[model samples]
Target: MATSWRTIGFEKNKKLFERAIEGGELGHAYLFSGPEMIGKRTLAVEVANKITNISVPDILMITSAGSESGQTIAIEDIRKIKNFVSIRPYGGAYKFIIIDDAHLMPETSQNSLLKILEEPNASSIIILVTACPEALLPTITSRCQEIQFFPHPRTIMESVLAEAKLSKANKEFLADFADGRLGLVKRIIEEDSFGEIEGAVKKIMYLAKADINERLDAAQKLTDEKNKAGLPRLVLYWMLYLRTRLSEPKAQKMLSGLLALNEIVNKPQYNHRLALENFLISL
Candidate 1:
């Protein structure tokens, strides 16, 4: 049977796993950091399984002190864990706590957790997983052994896509648009949302090439679809496309316009329709 942690290609982290398995050098606390959907939590869970030898259960597990059933890890959840750590393990040699989305833990909660890290219980391990490690407090980070996970290469991504039985055309588009995020590829394939997004992109491109009102209309539609993020992304792509097909001065103007529009959309108070209208008028 395939091991849980071994499923996501941890060859590069093999040494770390081996050391942990060997037992003596295992750290009391670990921070697993990587982009979202890159299997950080999977590795953490595998480690927990190996340590606890607990039969895999579908329950939501957390490390916080006060979390009720179904609640994600909260400050109270961390508080609840302190009592468990003081006790000895019943089944396995070690007790493991896997904290998912540790970066989302508030400062007070993280600070509360720091005390446990500073004086870790023997035979207990805490694994913290997060997509944005930098957002975590320095004190908490400094107390834990950090492991960083990088995106898989294109070749590996292609292999994963093949295993999923995705169409070749869809796979290529996903590979380009997902920025090596396998999670995104899985979502796109499962939902079959690529065609809709592609149609929207094409419509926006056509509008960009038409009159100012057309561009404004396209922007409004984009915002309506909750694709505000895609607006700047598409504009950048369109500007580059135009650069390849137009003179230097025209390309420069397009780049400047795209950049201005990007800034407008990025503003927290941006009036989407008004901003789009202004951008269209400028174009």
Candidate 2:
């Protein structure tokens, strides 16, 4: 019944949206940009919910892309949004079109979105959420009001974990390991899928010191599809692990290698095994 952003940790973004809503200056389109799992999508949804008076779950026009969507927001997705925007609101005065991972839209699809942005829709709001806004066209970004989300402060994250009623050990693990991503913490806690990452983080040190055979063994083990699901999390934890070792001379180089490998693994056409092996052996 009330418009609230308790689910998001970014205070500035909350205030910004609140102001826009209160002033009746809410824009026709907005771009929400931030790091992965840093709450861009959450804030985008909340903004849409507030403006359209549509209960969060009932907002049928919302769209999101993921690995299953082939990692790109296709032209068909844009077409659906175009159709949604053309329709009038069912119950409320406003309707919404929220697209997550908007940057994943290739140039052509982005052009389709551009057509919508250029044509004014009085009753519709479009929100584009992405971790990689650079992948989107400059014109698309220029058409929308851009809002940036950032990692939650450590104090805020700690308070959130404390309220989750986790065990002391688990609480501490999340506190040290969350890296300001509450989404990641929740996923790891609820799914119990983080064990592989924990082990991998510990093994990173060993892998760094490991010889050719050990490195090759790790590369082989890590390249499986079953294990690939966990690689992103593992790389994330590895980056956090590197944070602690920044005092060492090789820390930057190690992190650079991991970042490069991460980029490769995220692309559909890249060879995950070769990238993993290259990073491991180089370490």
Candidate 3:
């Protein structure tokens, strides 16, 4: 599904690209780095939208999957990008490739991508999106135009939450409670059973103090409550929870491990139960 510039939360980012379009200064490659689910991916597609005349051309999206599903990005994925952009556009100005969770790429994949970045084709643009930019190689980061996405301020978040159909009081509470993640806020609106992430965080605190057996039980219990498809969003909830408390030394430590855990969860072949157990056991 395509998203409009007005639909996503990043009006400023939309305008930035619009200016770039007018000035004809768009780069061949870009890096959209920020927290998980904060409209980074949406904005990347929207940048494509600005030039596509609402008829989005072949905008290839590369992302992670389980080992059975080709695992994370491989050298072959880069080859696909090479083949995709090499073709001359029939109508559109350029081809676009948006790589979601690009930081999950293995070293081989990253090295393969570097070749594309070094001699980018003018007829195509690549956008690499990730929550953990630090995980990407420095060479990869240095070659692209890095755009940093941040959480929305309270007032802006309130407007984004308006689509949830909540009352004034409920909206205000969620605006602050969500801690500026537009994606988390949108999830609560779209999923009736999603529950409050704050409640999930509270459970995390309790689990942290529990016995190993109890903590392990809690991990399965949580996963069982949601279908496997929800795992990525579930991971984002925990990430956002830890992200809000980065000033705390303990949370800062937990977030580092959470990032590595995040990389594997999207892969269907990975054992999510054991992964969650390990996280809780380490606590």
Candidate 4:
């Protein structure tokens, strides 16, 4: 298969696109949505190369210029792609435009891209990659075929960790801490503090099972002003822990709380500290 370059654990996604190609039903634009480091960009690039039969880096690749601290995909970037796609492919069946972290494109940039999607060139393909699709306009999503990437299965994660020569004990710990997010696991391991983080998570898990006052005290400490930067990581660890406890009926009851906590942390308007504290205290 042309998309064989896709990383492990994306076989199903590769097959889906393969089937689309076989049926001559491959869409002009595709939205690849998922958590960070789940192979969305790799799959998108591989699929683009396959469909275009082009391997030229500069001619076929169009990447978004965005940053974590709120730099967005600008209108100028979209205009460049708009003009590029209008031209015929240099030496391929299709021209490819990939917008990484596309959800960060400001509303104006999204609107600008919408125009291109509306009048897509016959020999061009656009792929939008994002972790948070809800941030994108509905019109943009509605116009493109959506592909979702999820966390890898435990078996695949274990294989990847093994390839990296991680110890068996560390592999088991990361497999749980990452909740199937291979990129996160890799990052944690490279940081040399995975053991410390793991220990802290275990202590938090114990607090989750403790009495109300004890839980509240722990939450207060976790959400302390100076420790604010770590709150998100703390919440993520708890979510991973909660995932394992889902088989328990009592744990199942906290799903709503988890969702609420996740929402509060993601949105800036909410007092995330208070929200997290309330959720943890309740647990």
Candidates in order have lDDT scores of 0.66, 0.75, 0.76, 0.74
TM-score of each predicted structure versus truth: 0.64, 0.83, 0.77, 0.70
Worst 10 residues of 4 by lDDT: 62-71
Q: For residues 1-283, could you state the per-residue lDDT of candidate 1 as single tens digits?
A: 1233554565667567766577568888889887656677777776677667763431225732344422235667778668777777877667788888676576777888888898998878888887667667899999888998887677877888877776778777666656566655666678786675666456545665798666766667767646654554455445434544455675566557765665555332356567667766665
Candidate 3 lDDT for residue 1? 24
Off by over 4 Å in 3: 1-4, 7-12, 65-71, 167-170, 196-206, 216-232, 239-279
Query: Candidate 4's residue-wise lDDT over 183-234, tens digit each?
Result: 6776777777676676766876687689987877776776666665566556
What's the CA error at residue 275 for candidate 3, in Å? 7.6
Candidate 2 lDDT, 27-135, residue by residue in tens = 8888888767767777777767777675443254434333344455667778877677677787676777778767657677889889989996888888888776777
Superposed model 2: Cα runs more than 4 Å off: 1-4, 55-69, 202-231, 263-278
Candidate 3 lDDT tens digits, 1-283:
2334554556667777877787888888899988777788877877776565544556788876532334467767778888888777755787888998897687888999998999989878889998778778899899888888988888788666776678787687667657777876776777753465666677777877899889877778756635555666666667767877889998887888777777667543468778888888887
User: How do these models rank on lDDT, best leading?
Assistant: 3, 2, 4, 1
Instruction: Give the Å error, residue 43, model 4.
Output: 1.4
Best by TM-score: 2
